[model samples]
Target: MGSKPRILVARAIFPDIVERLRTHFEVEDNPGDGIWTPDALAARLADKDGAFTTGSERIDAAVLAAAPRLRIVANMAVGYNNFEVDAMTAAGVQGTNTPDVLTETTADFGFALLMATARRMAESERYLRAGLWTQWSYDMFAGGDIHGSTLGIIGMGRIGQGIARRGAHGFGMKVIYHNRSRLGAKLEAECKARHVGKEELLRTADHVVLVLPYTPAAHHTIGAAELALMKPTATLVNIARGGIVDDAALAVALRERRIAAAGLDVFEGEPRVHPDLLTVPNMVLTPHIASASVPTRRAMASLAADNLIAFFDGRGPLTPVNRPVAHPRGY
Candidate 1:
C-alpha cells in the first residue's frame, strides 16, 4: 500500500484522538490550540489528503482551490456551514458530519434551556444573589409549566424527534412539529406529535424550539412576522445553528415582552451575541455548548475520527453529508 496520506487537524482535540489518527495518517495536530486563519489552513492543507475539522474552521472556495490534494473533511459538529459545500463539491472534495451520536445529549440540553427560561431560573438566581429574595410571593417570578403545555419543534430530524418524544411522552405535553417534509404516520403516532404549518406551530405552541438546519433559504425562519404570531406568554428555545433566527428582532421581542422569554444556546455572529439580547432580563443565555456532555462530546469526536479512518481505508465514510462526493480523491 502507498504511504499513509497526510492529514491536518484544524483545532486542538483529545490527544487519544490524535493518536488514533496518527495510526492511520501522518497527523499534524494543533498542539498549542491556536486558531488558524484561512491562509494558514490553506497552507497546511495544500499537501494533506484530508482534514479533521470543527465548525469554526471554514473550508471555502479559496481554501479548496489552494488544497487540490484534499479529499475529505470530517466535521465534529452536526452543522457544516463552515464548509462551502457547493464549492467543495465543485473542487471534488468530500464532507462528513457527526450526527445521531449527539442527538440525545443535545436534546437534553435544549430541554434544560427551555425549562430554565420558562421558570425564570437564571433571573431568579440573580435576584437571590443580589439579596432581593427577601420573601417568596404568590407571583414572584411566576413562569409557565412544561406539563400539559404545547411544545412546538421546528425540524423533525433525530435530535428534534428526541425532543418531541420527551415532550409528548415524558412531560404529558402536546407535541407539534414543522419540517420540510412530513414524518410518516407511524413515526408521528409513536411520538404523539402532529405535523403543522410553521405559522400555526408558532402561534399555538406554549414553547417553541428551533432545531432546523441553516441555509440561505432558511435564514430568519423565525423573525418579526413569526415572533409576532407567538403567544405573549410563550417561551422560545433555540439549540440549532446561529442565523436560524433573527437575533436582533428576537431581542426586541423579548425586551418588549412581545413573547415571554427566550432561551438561546446559539446566536447570530457567535461567539458575539447581539447587545440587545444581553440587555433582556427574561432571556437565558449560554455559550454554544448543547452537545457538551463529556461522554457525548467524546462520542462525537470518535465518530468524526471513525469517518476519517473509514474514508482513508477505502471504505465509505460512516456519516457522509453528500454521498456521491464522499471520497473525492480516492484511497
Candidate 2:
C-alpha cells in the first residue's frame, strides 16, 4: 500500500466523516472539540500535511511558518476571514471554504432573526417566563410590522438574494439591497429587489439585515454613524460575521433605543457576547448558528471533506480562496 498523507481534524466533526478521512490519510481527530489556542493549533499542525478547520481557527503567516508540512486548510464555513489569504499564498498553501451549501440555510436564519426581532418575540418570551405578563395590553411589546415594510440587505450575494426572495415573496415586503456591484436586471426583477446605495438602504429600510462578508475593509461596516442613519423604529439583524458591526457601538445604540430592536446570531468576540448587549431588553442574541440546520450543516461538512479528499488525490481544490504557488516538493 502506498503511504497516506497525514491530516489534522482541528476541531471535532462527525465520526463518520473522520472514518472517511481515515480511509485516505492518517487522521488526527479532535473529537472533544477543544478550543485550541493559536500556539496549540500551530504546534499540532507542524507534523500534518493538511487540516480541516472552521471559522474559529485563525490560519495566518505565523501559524503557516510553524507548519511547513501543511499544504491545504479546508474551512467548513463559507466565511474565511479567519484565514490570512496573502500569507497562505506566500507559503504555497491552498485554502478552501464551504460556500453555496449554506447560503439558503443562512438566509432562512437571517429572516427568522429579523422576524423575531421586529415582532419582539424574544422580549415577550422573557416577560412571560419572568411572570411579568399580568394583563393583556395594546402597547405591551408593540413592534414594527414585517409585511409590506421595506427590507434592506447589505452585501447582495446568494444569501442576500435568498433573503430578498423570502421578504418579497414570502412576506410581501419591499426589498432594497446594496452590494459592491449591482445585480443583473433579470435577477433584480426575479428577486423583486431594487439596487440602492448603502446610505439610501440604511436610511430608508424598515428592517436592515447584514449579509456581507468580513474583511479588513468590511470591519465595522455598521458603526455608530451608520446606526445613527437608521430610523429610530427600524430593526437591525446581523447574521454576518462579528466585527462587521461594531458590537460595543451596537450595544450602546440598542440601550439608547437608536434602533427599535436588534437581533444577532454572530458577535465581535463570540461565543462571548458584549456584556452591554445582554443588558438591553430589546435585543435578541443567538449563538453563531445561522446555518445550523441539520441537513445544511451536514452538507457543509461533506463539502469540506470532499475538498480535502479531492486536493490530496492530485486534483485541484474545490472552492479555493487563494491560488497557492505550486511547489515542487509534495506536501
Candidate 3:
C-alpha cells in the first residue's frame, strides 16, 4: 500500500476541496456527481481508508461490512441520520458531520420559506406567470400577517434558536418552542421564547416550523393528526430532514385548506416530491437548499475534508458523531 491514506469523495465537491484532499491522501473523487448504488459505493470503498459523504449516502452495516479498511465517514451535512451510527461505532468507523457552520444560513432560509408561504408568494407568482393579473382584486392572495403572530418552533437547536431570534426580534412575533429539553431561563429570555408542549405548540401558533433531527422515533413527527391540530389560518415550514413530515398527509391538508399554506425545503422522499404535493397549490417547495449559501456550503465541505484529514493525521476528528474502536495508526 502507499504511505498516504486512501480517501473517497463520494459526491462532487469544489475542485479546491478535492485538491486539498489530494495533498493529504490518494483521493478518489466522483466529480461527475454520480449517485452510486450501494454495491458501487462498497466496491469503491473496499480499499479506501476514509470517505467524504453528503446526506444522500447511507453508510450502514452492509456498507461497513464491505469497507473493512475504512476508518472514518465524514458527512458534509449537519444531520447524520443517513448514517447508521451504532453500526459504524461497532465496526470501528468514526462518523463526523458539519453542524455549526450551516446554522445561521439554514435558519435564514427557514424564515424566508415561512414568509414566502405565509404571503402566498408562490401562488401569486404562478398567477402572474400564467397571465392572470388583469386587475387587482380585494383579497387577491391575501394571507396571514407575520408581524405579531405566534411562531412555534419544534426542535430548539441552534437553527431553531436562530429562527426564533428573527421572528421574536425582527418580526415582532411571539415565539414558542418544543425541544427534547427546555432551554435555560436566560437563553429563553434572550430569544423571547417560551417553552411549550408539542400539542400546545401545534394547536396555538400562527406558524409552525420543524427543525428537529430525524430518528426512527422522529419519523413522521408531523402527520395527519398533528396537521389537524393547527388552526386553519396557520402555516407550517419544514427545514428539517425529509420523513419528519408525512408528505402525503401534508398535501391533503393543503388541498383541503385545513392550513393556509406550507413551505417545505425537505420532503419525505426527496428530489422526488410526493405526487400529491405537486398538485397542491398552497405550498412552497425548495430542493433542500437551506444550508446552501456559497460561503456556508464551502465551509461545510471544508469541514468534512478537515475531519477526514484530522482522523488520518492522528489529531482526532473535530465533530465526531461516534468514537471509533481504534484510531487510524501508521497511515
Top TM-score prediction, candidate number: 3
Candidate 3 has a TM-score of 0.98
Q: What lDDT would each prediction earn against the true structure? A: 0.92, 0.92, 0.94
Summed backbone clashes in each candidate are: 0, 0, 0
Off by over 4 Å in 3: none
Candidate 3 lDDT, tens digit per residue, 21-75?
9999999999899999999999999999999999888899999999999999999
* lDDT string, candidate 2, 195-283, tens digits: 99999999999999999999899999999999999999999999999999999999899889899999999999788888898999999
Best candidate (score: lDDT): 3
- Global lDDT of model 2: 0.92
lDDT of 1 by residue, 113-203 (tens): 9899999999999899999988889999999999999999999998899999888989999999999999999999988999999999999
Ranking of candidates on TM-score, top first: 3, 2, 1
TM-scores for every predicted model: 0.97, 0.98, 0.98
